[model samples]
Target: MKKTLLTLCSVLCCAVLFAQVPATEKQALLDLYVDTQGDQWINTWDLNEAVADWHGVTVENDHVVSISLLFNNLNGKLPASLGNLSKLRILELSFNKLNGEIPAQLGQLSNLEVLALNANGLSGTIPETLGALSKLKQLHMSSNKLTGTVPASLGNLTAVEVFNVFDNDLKGSLPAELASNNNLRELMIAENDFVNTEIFSVVLLSNSGSGLNLKSPSLSPQAKTIIAIESPEDGN
Candidate 1:
């Protein structure tokens, strides 16, 4: 009986110890991400290793689990190998001076939940490959130089809740498939040159309250509904 009890205790300890994040791995990755920015400083923002002190990046076993690096002076291109941290759940890199188009390789993080890259200087189109992230819940890529129409593939994120891309230079109409995003709550697409819109989902403030002429027959239902709410005078 004594021997059996000791074995059971050992097993339990191992299980708990192997759980999300080994301290060394977490610190290593955190150090790498912060140090990636080196000593770059823009405006009032500056990237410092000390900033990682307030971050909550941790690793499970050998995998990074969560990393929230908001408002850091992280200037430079994102590493192409970032998807290697497969266990990430929340990745918030908003309010940074990061440049370059978002790598399509980032779409490989299937476990990701919240991805916020809004209000930055990121340029390029949203990758259609991001539709593969089945577990993603919140995605905000608003306020950037992101050209091209919104990717219809984003409709695959059925779990998505809050989606916004207001105040950008994105052209083309919203896709009808986006209406399938029933879990959507706050869909902000105001202040853009987007045309040929349709609305069949979501709630929004009437930026113009209907006066749109969606020239595209393929306008998504959600886009049409958004246009319907906008008055003609507000469509400028």
Candidate 2:
């Protein structure tokens, strides 16, 4: 009876194996979701299991376009080699313990659309090279330890949508060039020390000018635990 049960179990296992997706297909799925994160914070990405099963991240497909990993508890600095993903269209790395400056190499991704790095422990000034991305749409870098003025060259982004940098230690005035952008929907600069951002037409201008600080005013849902975490209050 024991031998018969073992044989039955073996046959069932084999059947399940044949029904599993091909190795290449599995790799593709993992690669697509390798950096997926959601609205929740505090959960860091530990890809040890994925790495162990597949051995490494594969961003080789030139057709591959988007990669989002926001709100994942991925601590530590980003791997510089990621700059090699030239065909990448979207990249989001917000709300983590990632420190250090934004890699200038990221500017090389000419097709990049969205880039968010908010609510982290990051520092250093924004990279000027980011201005080079022609296809960039949304750019979020708020609620971190980032300092220095907003990148003046960011004015070059004509296709940008959301450009938020609130609740940080950033200083200096908003560059007048940003006002010229025609495609931007939101321009958030609240809870910091922004001087002005009277540029462009913003659908949501939540807190553009003063009264911004590291521990400044409490905009609803700004703390992350709230359900509907929308834009900050517009001081416009």
Top candidate (lDDT): 1
Runs in model 2 deviating more than 4 A are: 1-63, 198-236
Q: Model 2 over residues 12-37: C-alpha lDDT tens digits? A: 88765444434543444343344323
TM-score between candidate 2 and the true structure = 0.63
lDDT of 1 by residue, 1-236 (tens): 99999999999887766454445444445454554563453322133323223355544554676765666677777665666667778777777777788878779888998887767788888888888888988777766788887888887888887666765778776766666667876566766666644554554542333433323355454443442332111221
Candidate 1 matches the true fold with a TM-score of 0.68
Residue-pair clashes per candidate, as listed? 24, 10
lDDT of each: 0.64, 0.60
The positional error of residue 148 in candidate 1, measured at the CA in angstroms, is 1.0
lDDT of 1 at 100: 82
